[model samples]
Target: MNFNLLHEIVLGFMVVLLLVAVAVIIERFIYYSYIERSRKRLLGLLAKGDEQAVLKETKGSSCPHARLIGGMLALKGLEKDAFESKVQALYLTQQAGVKRLLWMVDTTITLSPLLGLLGTILGIIDTFNALASQGVSDPQAVSQGIGTALFATAAGIGIAVVCLVFHNYFSERVERINEQLKVMALDQAGAVAGEGSGVRGGREPARIQPQAAAA
Candidate 1:
């Protein structure tokens, strides 16, 4: 097979991955932002400390933070172990959700440059082959190889950088959300404990009234 052909194939594959990475990055960014907003809203509601209002506001919410709060509210005199278990479960669920499509993004970041390098090597080989067969008589033939090689390298570098930036941004955002969740869980756990010792007395947690539950 011709080195030129192989090089083009590798470049083609790199282009495909770049396209997929762009799509995934945009999707993940939007989804994560949505989750963050929902979490923030839940936290804002949680801060009010009105048991009925929290449940009412969070009713039908799908945010992991809201779910965690819900679990906390549900437990009246239950052991801390049960609440801890819920916390762990919520963390795992949030982690899994945040990581959706991250592997593809990471793979593109790692593979793009390697593919570009492979293409560059093949381009060099093609240039040499052209020079030998055509006796350096055709400068255009050699130049074409060099151009293709450089093009692939530039494209790969560009793709990799974008992916890396996106991955880092997402990682930071996930960490922030998780931290907020942990803090809220601890605070609410304490509140639940304190209230458990109050007049509520191990009864069912306060529920949102349907009339006020409309979001």
Candidate 2:
């Protein structure tokens, strides 16, 4: 019934938590709205061996995964070692981008419980202080302190739960995409190498003819 105590318990932490939550929601929306579609298009282009099309599709986009695929395509004629190196570099870059903002989600999950514990400690301290001043015989005053203390713990756990769920789901999606990328890279590499070998084998070295003596 006492909102003042609830406000005191939630206070600044609630605002911070709300902001973090909003950020996560926005990130998720962007991922699904734009990044997800781009990924599907990238995969399709890779499957069709349309490197130019893939590059064009991702040229203006900031998606890391798309950039990785494009980078590999750019090295199409390079030797195996060079191509692999380029691909690996691009893969690492894309991985980092995919994992961006994940740390914040992790931090929220880690901090939520601690914040709740802090609230609980403060509530207990307040309750004991009240008891000392007003006497232990007053149950109503004691209840107020205990109730306020529990609010922090509840909020912390709730925030952590939400963050954990999102983190796990996003992580799984990323893993699946990474797997697909790996497979596509291997297949493309083999196809390109085979073509290069066939061309080299069919070609003959140039022969030089002696020049006729000048008068």
lDDT of each: 0.71, 0.64
Per-candidate TM-score against the hidden true structure: 0.79, 0.77
lDDT of 1 by residue, 60-172 (tens): 77676777677667765666666556555654565666667889999999999999989998888888887877787777867876887788888888999999999999878
The residue pairs in collision within model 2 are none
Instruction: Report how far off residue 107 is in candidate 2 (Å).
Output: 1.2
How well is each residue in 62-161 modelled by candidate 2, as lDDT tens digits? 7655665556556668776666666666555666666677778888889878878777777777677667767979788688768878888888888888
Report the number of the highest-TM-score candidate: 1
Best by lDDT: 1
Q: How many backbone clashes does candidate 1 have?
A: 0
Q: What is the lDDT of residue 180 in candidate 2?
A: 52
